[model samples]
Target chain A: MIETTQLTKRYGNLTAVDGISFKVEPGQVLGFLGPNGAGKSTTMKMIAGFLAPTSGGAKVCGYDVESQPIEAKRSLGYLPEGAPSYGEMTPRAFLEFIADVRGIAGDARKRRLDDVIGRLQLEGVLAQPIDTLSKGFKRRVGLAQAILHDPPVLILDEPTDGLDPNQKHEVRALINAMSHDKIIVISTHILEEVHAVCTRAVIIAGGKLLADATPAELETRSRYHGAVSLTATNTGEARAALARVADIESIEIDPQDHRITAFPKKGRAIFVAVSDALKAQNVTVSELALEAGRLDEVFRTITQPQIKGGRA
Target chain B: MNPIATVFRRELKGYFATPVAYVFIVIFLILAGSLTFYFGGFYERGQADLSAFFIYHPWLYLFLVPAIAMRLWAEERKSGTIELLLTLPITMFQAVLAKFLAAWAFVGIALALTFPIWITVNYLGDPDNGVIFTGYVGSFLMAGAFLAIGSCLSAATRNQVVAFILTVVACFLLLLAGFPLVLGFFQTILPQGVVDAISGLSLYAHFDAISKGVLDLRDIVYFVLTIGAWLYATAIVIDLKKAD
Candidate 1:
């Protein structure tokens, strides 16, 4: 288990991370969501025992981070922002150093090293210096170092930030593969990543926790939730026909694509009613979708007010 | 494996991982060789001793040791690897000590590579091998002291150039504290006890005593104390400035 109680970090007059508290159990991947400079990295640093909190504290596997740093850190694996490593060393040598520092020795050491190397596909670059490797290879090496010992708690800052689409998919798949028994915390600004890998997300803005919920739960707060959007042959006729449906509270047309969206009233399923109305008017619909929710819209709604308030 | 030993192994190998180690070792050997033979007048001294060689180490280390120490912490901070290092299951003191020891050992290797000088002296005439051995010990201790001071100053900044310049300036001041020119100036203004105290803290004074074939307990303690104090300051400085 990973637990932080009222953790805070301050830099002179600026409070970088406010009093934030949360907990993570095993088999759960927690996504730390925030805007740029929203203290996502700072909070991860505190939890990893890289930065001492100005107030409050954290515990990993019941060991206090401040008082029992060694014990807490022993159980934790952290990939710092930018995936920093000794650039002069090869992926093989770098992983060896990390493995040694993490106390993975003897037969188990080689096994763990090979496991991460194979998993991250770093075998080809094992001999080349990290400084000469491409950005994607460097990130994979960083991930390899973090998972070399297979620590129970893994904290990664911007794990997939610089990866290409395929690399991003592979890293997400890796996170999902490792989320079975580990308390993995990854911080990213990408909203779709939360849907892809996170079992729970803690959104912070201006160094304050704004919301903590599952991706599905947070998306439900979007105005687009339960809304039905369709591209039809006669958009105006379909809009008139949809007005007869009692469930839909409002209707809107896309200015660019001319698609019609029918928003349902509270606790109403508008997909069936809207389809029935479109068919009744003999309107030929080309494409239709019942949106689960618009996470970007919900993210903006949840975080934009504070941005305007100038809290960060 | 022990944490310090593990970090020490990596740090030491880290030097060989780049051209820095080969460059530093080659430069150190060249400078030490020429300074001993040409500047110190090894042949002209006509004595069966390495006094000429040992006399120039304090001056030689002033620039070269800082080159080694400057990158100790500064590079870690510049490349953002300090976060990865500090997050490992190692104490701050262990990290500081391991890095220092690795750098010190690297310098030791460079110093030992000057074995031809030892053979040259012995081949020239019958010299007291015991004195030469003590001089080697003293030179290694002084290098350790210099490296410790450099380690602390390196931790104070992320820029290696800044760290190098600050370490050079600090070590120069400490070395000059024992000089007659500096002591004479302080003698006219400060009290006798204060002047004596200043000279006592001088690395040159303690190193001079050891190099002159007198391995006094006080001189050894001075170097040990200097290494201990500076390494302690290094840990504290790293803690205070790491987040920046």
Candidate 2:
């Protein structure tokens, strides 16, 4: 439901969103991942029609954001960074205002307002001023405003930023429930959020799209650079015995724990051979398992190193 | 009604939903009453004209209108709500006009609260109430002109303090453009025709004509065109800074 061309956003000398193109089809929960100053928010803003791209264009539901902004914007709901809200208004009042602006009137307005408020669990604090509420509560109110219109496309920037664990779960569940009908692009720097919620992941670093893949694929890529561990009672015996195993890249002994950790490309087979060799040596194996790479590891390895270099 | 009216109603009600409308009305009534009776010298001048009341409005609005208008778009930018607002189905022109009209209507409500002064003037003498009524029209128009400029300036800055200061500076320049100090400075540098044209652009001149009970078409057109020009400028500024 959303497509971007060679979209680029430049602020004087800095290119915030550098010529990155991506598409989000309907019913896809696309997790937009990037570190700070990575242009995830800038890309989302361009797609939402809030910012005009410097070089290319973005389209929402087939309507070009620059040429047909009103139609494109009408089809999308955006929750901006920091979850901006009018502090003087209550949650109920703010949602009502958004409903009014969205042109949902009469029973539809009332029903949608009821649904969002109830789903966000904002009943108790609905009447309290937003400025008086906690940050988490305020974020819920922002979420309520975003989904009140129930647009077909949803672009949420840092949707679960300040929420406690329970509130985050509620928001995640709400997003998961709505994933069937909307094209949701959630921009966040949290790796665990991608694995937990997103159907697809797009990793961006230094204002460029670095990788686009599924969580499993990213983890598989992590495995290409990972190691397997083998822990035993006597590290010296285990290491010497496992030395005969093929593809045993390196071995390290932990002096305190007396554990032998092995680095191997064929993680599982090499671990199995090390286990058999240690068994032959009469060395009791305490822990012998292939360490599967995690999405967090992949995220750090792919995005963090480039961020350190501050490269474009 | 147009969809613009829908936006207008919501925006207008936003002011009343909080303490802004009530406080503005109450304070305006008290000050207007005091000005007409004691400070404006309505009875001491012993005149049927409401020049006393209308004369003080431009100065009163110099500060009051900015307080009402400083949040038109500045607060929206500061709070990050402008994105949500602009993404609605409404066009930018509609949103700009709706916001401007809402603020203008608010100033109208505050102006309407000064009716007790009108009632007092009517009760006291055979005043030309038509002249007084027309004077209010001119004052309302002038207030709208001031508000339009303030709204445009507010859209340019995120800080309300900066918006207020810039608005005061802009309105002050318009107010003093035709004054003797400014005119004297311009007489040496500018031709007489250009100087006359510049002085005619002053809001104070046309407003003064209407306050004297003269309903010249040119004076009415002047206020309308000035308001329209500033509002159009406001729409352009908003479109330029859409991201904020």
lDDT of each: 0.92, 0.84
Best by lDDT: 1
lDDT of 1 by residue, B131-223 (tens): 898899899998999999999999999999999999999999999999989999999999999999999999999888888889999999999
Clash count of each predicted structure: 0, 0
Tens digit per residue, CA lDDT, model 2, B96-133: 88889989998998898788777877788879988998
Model 2: residues with Cα > 4 Å off, grouped in runs: A223-226, A230-242, A252-261, A266-271, A274-289, A308-312, B1-3, B17-20, B184-189, B242-244
Model 1: per-residue Cα lDDT over A187-224, one tens digit each: 99999999999999999887899999999999899889
Cα error, candidate 1, residue B99 (Å): 0.5
Candidate 2 lDDT (Cα, 0 to 1): 0.84
TM-score of 1: 0.98
Q: Among the candidates, what TM-score does chain A have in each?
A: 0.98, 0.88
Give every collision pair in model 1. Answer: none
TM-score of each model's B chain?
0.98, 0.94
Model 2's TM-score against the true structure: 0.92
